[model samples]
Target: MISIPFSGSKRNRYKEVKQIIQDNGYKKVYEAFGGSAVLSVNLFREGLVERAVINDYDRLFDLYPAYLDIKDTLIQKCLEAGFIKSNKRLNATQRAYLQSMIATIDEKYWRLLANNFVFSGKQTGSLKPLYFTYFHNDITTDKQREYLQTVQQMERVSMDYKAFLKQYFKDFDDTTMIILDPPYMNSTQKAYDNRYFFGLSATLQMLQMVKEMQVDFIFFNMIERDVIEVLKVFGFQDFEVSTRRITQTSTSSREDCLAYVRNHF
Candidate 1:
């Protein structure tokens, strides 16, 4: 199995996931809930799958292509515009500059860096300093340019993912396979804020709709009793658990990892 390490895996459970999809005769697959799109990318890269169907409710996905295409151009502009230094400790003027940047610079710079930034990754827009500080020119200009160029394909790949899902899933049938990874409740997301919270119920409803039409799918779900009961009612019998993350990672004093889909998947 092609293992992409972007998200957590419990005891090689993802291996089982890869195997199930491969054995099902599904060359064209769907990622119904693509958090990072890592798995689809892995499958495409490893030649285990021929095409993909990736969808997420988040609108930020629309910006992925633009971000990839312009990533280096934006960084170069920042450097040319006087961005410099490492761990020099943001001084008053520099801090003010960063604050000002949060207001006018590209949103991509901010959204990607909010994790380790000052605002703890929840703030809206590019108002945090963490968004702008990663613009250091640590490598030769040529290398940085090449690296960003490589990422530029994300735009093309995203576009391809969108088109493939639209064209193929319009008539989803027994031949089609769905990989479900519905969002679970967590710190960065909540029931009302992110679609995954109360969204699970709605997503399950969607799954029911698809299943009724004879769509072959397996859910990698949060082992909520209600959700489990709902799946059981729909005749879903197979499951496996993976402990990706249970609660908010930043707030937990110590990791309180919860078992999800471990034995159930």
Candidate 2:
């Protein structure tokens, strides 16, 4: 899979999460917030699912299937944007160029650059500080080429999860499952602008709808009061909670209940 740098990517937990899906014997999979397409691509690559569908509100996801069509141009442009090189620190002119390039590059390339290079990999709409000197060496032409092979003509939808399910949930059968990683429960309003952000009420509503449909689901989130209450109301009793945090050069544990709920309603 192409290693796109993404903030809050579930890359670290993919294996653990995939095991839950495997144990549940879901033949068809849908990732509701397909961030980085990490889980979706891995499932497809490993032949773990008969069909995998990915959807997200992020605009960049719309261009994923087209990565092959523009891979070479994007690589050259990334080189020009200084992502293919090392610079532990940026000089004034280099910073100025990046600040200006933000407006000059095509939207797709800009999205790629910002998401991959910016500090924390945030969608800041401007050139934020660089994350570090060098991107992972794996982000090379060969990698993109291989990733294109996996994503080309793959099933994907760019829309809100609610609307997406409204249109497509009936297509799923008992063998199908939804894997969800919506924004954190206490996310700031700005962080989850309700436009692209799935809020708590929306999440609760989706859970209700999924229970009604009786499709199995695997959900990832932080354990907050409302989440626990919702789980109680839905009659879901299986969940795992742990503390996980990662930094640039270190991994640390914190005191919090990071929840994983597998609801076989």
Candidate 3:
């Protein structure tokens, strides 16, 4: 899996989830909330899924086409704007420059710039770049090439989960699988700043819709009693539990689960 600098990335657990899909004999896959597109990219690289549908309501999808079609210009703009080769905390001048870039650059490239450079890969806080001191030393030509190549090879869609489901996965059979990683109920505001967030009510509705669609799925979220109860209400009795070590601290951890739902017969 690629090292993506996005909030809520599941890079560490990609192998486990991929194994789950393989074990269940699902060859076609859809990702409803492709935040960092990490899982979809990994599946694409590993050839686990024959048809991979990557969809997201966020502007992050814009990066796919931009990276694939206009690679040189995108990298050149980042370099020219000092988004690359520097990791200083955003000063007044640097902040102003970023705002200007946000206005002028296409939404996809701007999304990449903000998330890749900003602290915690989040756009909510003060615009502090990812690395304070070793920023320049960390990025290399090889990493950039790998990222761009992965983006170019992906099949990306820019749309809401419901729309994508209705359009693509509505007729999915047992061989098809969908991965649903909606905003966690407990960390909606913290991880995504309430932007593009699927709140609890919306999440419940989506869950019901998924149940009705009858497509096989694996849902991921931070474990909580309320969420578990709701899953049980939807006939989800079993879950694959795991520990997620939060990046901000080593001692802190969260119980996470992958709730698998097989297709209706």
RMSD list, candidates in order = 6.4, 4.3, 4.7
Per-residue CA lDDT of model 3 for 93-189, tens digit only, reads 6566545545555544543454344554354434332222122333434555576577567777777688889998555888888888887776635
Candidate closer to the true structure by TM-score (higher is better), 1 or 2? 2
- Candidate maximizing lDDT: 3
> Model 3: runs farther than 4 Å from truth?
64-111, 115-117, 125-137, 188-197, 249-253, 263-265
Model 2: lDDT to the true structure = 0.61
Ranking by TM-score: 2, 3, 1
lDDT of each: 0.47, 0.61, 0.64
The alpha-carbon deviation from the true structure for residue 226 of candidate 1, after best TM-score superposition, in angstroms, is 5.2
Q: Which portions of model 1 miss their true places by more than 4 Å?
A: 1-16, 56-62, 68-91, 106-109, 113-120, 123-175, 185-197, 224-227, 244-247, 250-265
Separate clash counts for every candidate: 8, 0, 0
User: Whole-model lDDT, candidate 3?
Assistant: 0.64
Q: What tens-digit string does per-residue lDDT give for candidate 2 at 10-76?
A: 6766776578668877788887877666777777778888898888567555565454345455446
Candidate 3, residue 179: how far the Cα is off, in Å: 0.5
